[model samples]
Target chain A: MNYKASQMSQSKKPDADASRSKKIRQKRIGDQLRRLYDDVTNEPVPDEFLSLLEQADKSSKQK
Target chain B: MDDQAFKTELAELIPHLRAFARSLCGNATAADDLAQEAMLKAWKARASYQAGTNLKAWTFTILRNLFYSEKRRSWRRQQLDPEVAEATLVSNDNPSSAIELLSLRNALDELPEDQREALILVGAGGLSYEETAEICGCAIGTIKSRVSRARKAITEILESKMSGLTGNDSLSAADAFEDIMRQADELSRDLPADA
Candidate 1:
């Protein structure tokens, strides 16, 4: 009974460690994605595009 | 169409859409334009978008179609090879630390458009092969093949780049820290430095 308990404890420890490591990796990847988003969004929206979207919105409103 | 509802849905998707576009286009300016064009297309085709379906996948399909259409019609036929450009960028200072990361990005950049799109949809967008196939308007088997090819090509490129670095036995904990710092620096350009 004691041996079984020790064996169970050993398996449990690895699972816990794996979960912790997975969380860390998840957070790191999430942070990288967030950073990529920020970089992409911070750039100036092109003039032709801004004008095009404005025209698009106006056309929709007229309908 | 309910303007408020459309806006809310679009707001939620902008970041993911941008990431997908950027990954496809390999740069910021082109990606923003691609994403904006996609949103416009989505807005115009709002009636076709069935409720409860994948908005991100819909937007991705629009962007991919637009990108290919533009490429086909454009007069500037000679495009700069992204892999070669990436390779050129590798001769920067501190090659010891940043080489692996830069090479990986370069390998990704070097991928064929279809394979890159598949990898981004699966690896980055967290979409399954079925969803990716749907977005790309291809078969599930095709999507799987593209992703497999992309991973293999990228791994090959990265391994070749790292071969020399592996010989240097002095890659210590400090070197690892330097790599993290280098990545953080590159990442800072992509986000608010404070973030």
Candidate 2:
């Protein structure tokens, strides 16, 4: 959904410093979050999770 | 969906579920437990899942609900010190990335649970606001506000830390800070705004 902030900002004169700083902060945080997400996502799937899936598959077959 | 298709979709979503769980719980072990539990729950409820719907969001909703329920239970057992939780999550390998990640994690941990969840669902999980709002059980506007507040809070935290440091540390921090700020500034300028 389009954020109200983005919508409201469209109709008003932008405050240079405030908007600039806000954008910088948002981008920096986004970058860091992406790194964290990737780090976690890239980790190898553990053996236990594999076993759990196996068990699930077996159980579903029995059903 | 057929059971085979359901299983395939569920398998594909496990990595994302695990990653999001890790972000929420901040500990690898707990994250794994949460992910495992969520998978089991999803498997049990697979019949309810509609065909051609967003399986990832459905699993996320299950995982998030489990996390919150577990969080409530843990809170009753003992108060968890955020600093202690963070220390356990931070790794010593790759000093630079570790430090940056630690700070980012700390900042994320500082956010209210709703705001953090909203930010993670949208920013990190790459889910649309509509999906996040559905997962969060809130209006789309509320999700946006939560994300906005979360970003603002994280920026303040990192900015304060950057300002507090000196010499070489400050230089590196400033460099990263300025790089993002410049990009953001340019982006803002490119977007249409009333003169």
Candidate 3:
């Protein structure tokens, strides 16, 4: 699909102001997504998943 | 690979697996269910797992597949539930940061599944473009485009919501716009003059 070609063309066409705004927005979004990622990753693993893994290990040992 | 080593790797990957699952589903309960199911599936197929390959990618592939399959089933169930349909229109009344995060999550949930997956895999999961492409079964360019589009969509949605909130409330839209413009100005100033 020549995705890179199209993307490059789009970037080259945008003027400095437009491109600057786009970059700013992209950076802001990246920061927000990083925060969201941190929030999710820092959460403790639920006990059910730990119990489930133990069960799986025991059952696999029986096989 | 020894079973003990493999088990340790899997255990260490559980948090990331859950993070990916949560990013995919946006519901803690459903994410845990998906993660647990994927872990069980990975354990069952551990014999087929190659020694040196990326286990995280392999397990993520399994979880993504399971999520899609379950989504297909739940799509039908949601169609039959009036409450599920109604929930789409309900908005968070509180405009606190917590509510803003909820709105951000909702915006993410609204993105096309492929774009959301690409964005999360790269932005959150710390996977390389090549790794994400391998997991998604697409070219690296496609993954890049997906992530770019996802970022744009999320930013636009959040900006519109922010402007909307500022327009009617204590905060002024002009101030919000000025803040964004100031940020953009700083970014532009940091750029090289010629290019």
Clash counts per candidate, in order, are: 1, 0, 0
Taking the tens digit of each residue's C-alpha lDDT, what string does model 2 give over A1-63?
479887876656457656766665566568779878877788788878868887988977898
Docking class of 2: acceptable
lDDT of 1 at B156: 64
Of candidates 3 and 1, the better by lDDT? 3
Per-candidate DockQ versus the true complex? 0.18, 0.40, 0.36
Query: Which residue pairs in candidate 1 collide?
Result: A39-B190
On TM-score, who's better, 2 or 3? 2
Clashing pairs in 2: none
What's the TM-score of every candidate structure? Answer: 0.61, 0.74, 0.71
Q: Where does candidate 3 chain B have its weakest 10-residue lDDT segment?
A: B76-85
- In order, the Cα lDDT scores of the candidates are 0.65, 0.76, 0.73
Residue A34 in candidate 1 has what lDDT? 40
lDDT at A21 for candidate 3? 65
lDDT by residue (tens digit), candidate 3, A1-63: 499999987788678667776776577567657766776677787787778878888887898
